[model samples]
Target: MDISAPSLRAVFTAVKTEFNAGRSTYTPTYTRIATVVPSTTSSEDYAWLGEFSRLREWIGDRHINKMALHSYSIKNKKFEATEGIPSEYIEDDTFGVLMAKFQDMGYAAATHPDELTYACLASGWNTLCYDGQNFFDTEHDVGEGENEKLVSNMQDGALAPWYLLDTRRPLKPLIFQKRKDYQLSAKTDAGNSDHVFMADEYLYGVDARVNAGFGFWQQAFGSKAELTEANFNSAIEKMMGLKSDKGRPLGINPDLLVVGPTNRSKAKALIEAMQKEGGASNTNYQAVEVMVVPWLD
Candidate 1:
């Protein structure tokens, strides 16, 4: 959990080398996978408002509100509202829809073999801001198209990027107490709190899938603690099945899997076990190409 600066740098170096070596000019696409719990009360609405308010308070009201409005407008264009509420307004909120839109546009491309697609899971805290006025009126107003271009710049030759939200759903209770608990635990015993480093509202909403993706890629690529070709191959095979399990063939196979350190460890163990089994069975199989990255704290 206490990843030193040197360790962080080393990881980045490895990531950059792998990414640049496999870098392609192909435009990277992405897929958005998300989960949401429906809101059932005004308190729920207030909860979202409060969370958004907290973000605004941290940066400034003008910035947070504007960004929210702008994001809403962009998404609203695609999702027409039926009455006073926008049709896209699921009880959960618009974040899910925005992510879905990105996926539909192919932003979240797969990282499979043959296709040689690079895949990544991106997450961050409240990196956007909006005012009561037009949401587009801020220094952060990169148009949707421009946002895509910015993300493309980060692909570094991978096929697609998968954006994951690892935060509380809008309208959900803000568990500040849970965050306090983590902080207290971290201060007391480093070994006692594995969840101490877990993200909280203060860090902004990041998706759990981002963690999963990080774990998935590290194991698939053999970039973590254990380095082995067999493990990598097994990881890739499992990913292939996940990508298209229902007999619907996705024309491409992921060449790369992007994941974080925590999930990477889990994925590594899973892949190693699978490989051992396959070796025992004496089956010839190719490993998967994967990349592991840590996007945020």
Candidate 2:
């Protein structure tokens, strides 16, 4: 495998094939729990998220809800992954390894969104949402004055966190803000590139601009306690009982449960089992789809 332009091009094609193949094999889980929001500039304002409205019977004039302009925004962040292969690797006929490397790179690139979304989710306990409250806090305002009731979306404890989500709605608990889709690029112009001339290497990389942020905290419940059936039931109860700012039922249906490697067995036994451990009829059987994600780990 001599370092001719044609040969280098052949290597690029092979590497790109592996990269695409890698991307094709991955099944990202973020789509299930995050809404994709396209961004045009460096950031997108979500200050309008201050309210969630519902349809009501018409009386007279239309009720207009003004955007609060709370300065809440999701800024796009640039991300990149790059690798350079020594010209000697192609000369040594080790392009197969490079193919695998690019494939893994593609896999990693595909998984990045999930990583950001879930990390944003996992930080719900502390990070603020559009309402100026932690996405999973216990002090979210449901109403004003005497009608106000402090609500919580999280249960704190000393263990790995698991999440219950209501994804039946169009908007999910998280937002994946993508400014630019991930793309693969190469700098194999050996005649013109200083990197190629000086380093005797060909560079390949993937880059994109994307970020993740919390959506409706009302549609999600996080627990750091043990992942038990009782706790699961409690989480479901909490989420289902959630009310809107106007004190209307949010109608949140917890349809998905997310867990990490440490809580896989617990999550499975709680939902996947046909019966409770006591031989009693399991009331929570197949209640919700359980997702096991390594990114959560």
Candidate 3:
């Protein structure tokens, strides 16, 4: 194999091709539970998150919509994965494995959003949201003054957590904020790149600026209790009965149930089975789409 500039560039191109192909072949699951919000800055503010208003008759002056200036924010985060192949391997034509690894790198980058989104959700019991409370707390404040009340989106217990989401709205229960999409880059110039000169290896990497946060907490319910018919029904009822600050129904309908692998069988029986184990018709069969992800406990 030639060790010239053209040859090195060609190798980079080949690795990038494998990477792009791997990216295309990977399927992502985050979009079903989160909304993608393209970001233009290092961070974004959601202070205006709770300003949704209801229309009133215009007999008097017209009502105006307003946004709070600095209520909540999510800062974009940097992430990277790097791999290298020794010059000896490329020169000796033994870089086949490195090519496969590059393809896998692409697959990993594509799957990163799912990892982040679900991990953020799994940690929602502690992470604060626009309301200055945990995203899945049992006491999110609603309304104001005498009308103010404490509302809960979480059912607490010592069991594995499951989630119910109303994803039909314009904004899903989770937010995926991306400032830049993952991209492949290389330090392949053997003579020019300091890394190559020092290590005698060509480097390749994928990097992105992205982060995940909670969206409208009203659109999601998290329960750590045993997953049962009674509990599932309670979650559904709770979500459907949620309202906005002004006491208007938010029309939350739980259309997705997300569970970890530990709850796979129960989730299947709750939503995917046509009949119960005892021969009774399963009234909750297919009540919502179930996603048994491996990310949560």
Candidate 4:
């Protein structure tokens, strides 16, 4: 059978399909529950889920219940309240006039344009990067001593492979909360706790979750390596030839090469070199796309 090279879109689609499959199969600690029980205080306890399937051979209880801390800082080790920040006050001197005008014109702009914009796109970056997945399986989650290998590696200022998914496995390498909702005034302050006048204000809160689970995935330490054609090819080979927890060939066919800005040019050159017909470094000739992740830099 004659076969030409796959299109870039085809290759990317294949990679994304594998990614989605990995996500779909992911067994979060609370996958059995219809609604996650909010931990009044954060704790790593998913024991209520009972015995895990063979699919969860790599995951553990420690990977569950990662709290979505809107008012705390895990990295800085401090309480970072979302409210109490100074907001610019704009007195609508025309409120009375605006209402009268609305009655006549049938339209009145109550909120500012910038305010609406920020409200809509506040979590743009996180949503894009994580594919709209929540970090936690529980509600309003926060915790101490909960260890995530990815977050810990980042905290230690190290570069590690955050994930290596094997679709054949019964368990997914990653599990996201899949939460996507927001309330304009989810947080009620002292003045607005029980009942309040218009003067009492409320703060918006995101129905966000925390990310957990690292044992299900693989971690590679390669940030210290120099960016070169040899290194790039070697990394790909390493990924493709990975072994599972059971020590069998994982058969991981990596199709995307993600890099930081510092190595963008080098990555581009490597991609081009591999795509060039009859090129010395094009032995494998696997079509892998390159993506420069700005946040990685």
Candidate 5:
């Protein structure tokens, strides 16, 4: 059945709203987070993240918003925080105290895992880093050369210094193509005093780098265009045509198509359209695996 434009849009919007409402149940909290592995043996050191813009944002916009060309060299240091279980509380309580202790530990276990995914996804949707000069109505030159670091003092280093456009090193939040081989552990203090004890926890983190640029592994900007077969095909072309840092054509066949909840039906239609076996065959057939991401919406 043919769908009218207005009706189709409405359907897309409604699907997104409903999917978002029940999305929590289907979200795998660790899918993206668990991809990062230990970049360093010690947590005190910093993990370097790299990013390279395949194309400047202005090129795609109708209005040219001329901005500095950025190549990133951001650093992600492992963060350390402590949460403890009192011996008295766990030891004295007879009912569910042990379980409660375990629950608290679970939260601690989840904290870093959740944070890694959050940070990576957020960076993709947001800017890499901001230097104070680029605050309001102006933008800063990310500068050239790896030696030239755009260091922004975010509250006297309350967080790792946000760096911008360092050619020496490409930076991105930690993203890995292979399974991260590592373990999470909590260590008890060597000795206890005053019946108060402490356990220090450490999470291994990797800096974000471009594992897959302008392709399935990397997030793509959809230009606020409504999802459709034609539009989706165009996006795939744009993605495949993306250039590398070396200014060479990145002949990438994107194996996955990630969409927001609003694009679910559109994605399905695009896939089905490609599967037809005749003159009706869509040029882009099974171009990529489609994944509906509610978090992206």
Candidate 6:
């Protein structure tokens, strides 16, 4: 029941240390090349395949370090070069070539659906057009012939770009509460194709550990209830929650709560109340376990 200021601080210190130490490594690779090619189309339809080969080599050279860092297994030998160029050679066709190169190199490339969505989310790109023709109007216009195909591909229901980025930056600390709207803010930029963007519309009410702990206490002790009697029941319920019980109505109270200098006195008062009730009562209820972990600063 009683949550000592020092105890709460210690818990916070542990959490902070864990956060700093926790690291995530995400290695994304594009899908297989054969998967992207339309079976019905003749090989002649893609004459620009050579460009794709060159692109693959370029990407492998540039991203080798990143791939190594993430432990990707792709090697140049895996790339299966075609005998001759296909004939169609449309600008949109290049995407397929890019996909193949990515696969051969073992870089996780987005699925067709994800690819278009990602492009639109990045700066200098748009999935919609006034003419209802092209979905990806890059800062530089893609030729008219391929524009319609790109637009059509996008309308077919591509995944959002942020999804791909999430796969890449799985461990990035996110600011969840401020991102509750579908309309993305201009201030938030995806620094690289691999950087993940926390969706503005999905971040509402989400909090890191500190705020979450505060919320737990507010619900348990801030209610209009008797101090000596109610505090004892609340503390018991709070502990049960931490033990994995639902602790419904009150929800799971945090195992620990941290108090800064500003609120240290208030926290001490609450701890005293719990200590008294726990000592007097015959129940298992006791002082809330609080650990005081100080910030380095």
Could you tally the backbone clashes for each prediction? 44, 0, 0, 8, 11, 32
lDDT, model 3 = 0.90
TM-score per candidate, in order?
A: 0.20, 0.94, 0.96, 0.39, 0.44, 0.17
lDDT of 2: 0.89
Model 6, 92: alpha-carbon shift in Å?
58
Error of 5 at 18 (Å): 34
Q: Is candidate 3 or candidate 5 better by TM-score?
A: 3
At residue 170, candidate 6 shows an lDDT of 16
TM-score of structure candidate 1: 0.20
lDDT of 2 by residue, 119-139 (tens): 998888889998889999989
User: Residue 158 CA error for candidate 4 (Å)?
Assistant: 9.6
Q: Show model 4 residue runs off by greater than 4 Å.
A: 1-202, 217-223, 244-247, 272-286
Give lDDT for model 5. 0.36
lDDT of 5 by residue, 75-179 (tens): 333333333433343334332333333333334433434444434543442344233231211222333455343322111212111111111112222343222
Clash pairs of candidate 4? 67-141, 67-142, 68-141, 135-209, 135-210, 135-211, 136-209, 136-210
Clashing pairs in 2: none
Candidate 6: C-alpha lDDT: 0.23
lDDT of each: 0.25, 0.89, 0.90, 0.31, 0.36, 0.23
| Candidate 3 regions with alpha-carbon error over 4 angstroms | 53-61, 68-70
Ranked candidates, highest TM-score first: 3, 2, 5, 4, 1, 6
